[model samples]
Target: MQKFLFELNRNADFQSRYLSDRRDAMNGFDLSDEERHALAEPDIGLLFHLGVNGQILMHFAAFHEIEWQDYLQQMRDGIAAHGPVREGVYAVTGYEGVDAHSSRLSKTSDAEKGS
Candidate 1:
């Protein structure tokens, strides 16, 4: 997927709220045209370290699409591809339950790499 290095905006509450809202929005398949358009839009805000110091890398939006599992995996793969080399990344999603982000690449990986 496309690499987007970004920093956390606001506090953890922002993330909590975003997770909640995103979960609610994705829970069902019934999405309006606007929702579909937004989802289709390539906007992924990424967070990563950019240098030797604690410099923050922030990209407000970088959009992309993939299967839910692959979307999560690309998050990890993007990090591994750019961030510190890590073996695993894990978190719980209210919608998908437990989820993992890893460095595994896929055939369509090239399509998502350019932007």
Candidate 2:
């Protein structure tokens, strides 16, 4: 997905192809059904929960003409509806959430130092 977004951002030919036929543009990539659905549906929120980088996603949203505030709200809504990111560095472990993972790592580090 990141690759697709990156290409969409940088590759004019791909961008033109995507603007013309989204499904066709997506044909070459190994996107999962969910990813394809989100792209096809243009679900910004779901894409966020899928762990698409925000910087990359912003372009996707912009390409779709999504307003900036609306894009932010969609991400928040995705978190509310989907719990946390499901992939990438932001992925939640057991739904503890992204920040919780950092806290867990911190606590583990502190415990190790104490020992």
Candidate 3:
């Protein structure tokens, strides 16, 4: 799926096919049903949750005419709806997620320490 996005970003002909018919543009790719659905349905948020690189996903969103702010919000909404990225560079290890991370920061802040 990542490769497909990269190709779609680089190739004008492929971009045309995607604009005309997303399923057909995706013909040769061995994408999972979730991947295919996200692409075909043009779900920007779902794709983010599926772990697509932002650089590649940004181009894909542009093809769909999604505005920049909307694209960023969709990715944020995807994380809220589907949890953190399931894979890719954004995936964190054992550390807790955003809420916990923020709480930890507050706990150690100078204000919280009365400094």
lDDT of all predictions: 0.33, 0.85, 0.87
- Model 3 per-residue lDDT tens digits across residues 37-106: 9989888989989889899999889888899999998988888898888888777563245678898888
TM-score result, candidate 1:
0.22
What does candidate 1's lDDT look like per residue over 46-80, in tens digits?
A: 22211211122122232222455555554455455
Error of 1 at 33 (Å): 30
Worst 10 residues of 1 by lDDT: 48-57
TM-score of each: 0.22, 0.76, 0.81
Q: Which residues of candidate 2, in runs, are more than 4 Å off?
A: 92-115
lDDT of 3 at 98: 62
CA RMSD of each candidate after superposition: 16.6, 4.6, 2.9
Model 2 poorest ten-residue lDDT run? 89-98
Candidate 1, which segments miss by more than 4 Å at Cα? 1-65, 84-115
**After TM-score superposition, what is the CA distance of residue 72 in candidate 1 from its true location, in Å?**
1.0
Q: How well does model 1 score by local distance difference test?
A: 0.33
Please list the residue runs of candidate 3 whose C-alpha ends up more than 4 Å from where it truly belongs after superposition: 92-115
- Indicate the worst ten consecutive residues by lDDT in candidate 3: 90-99
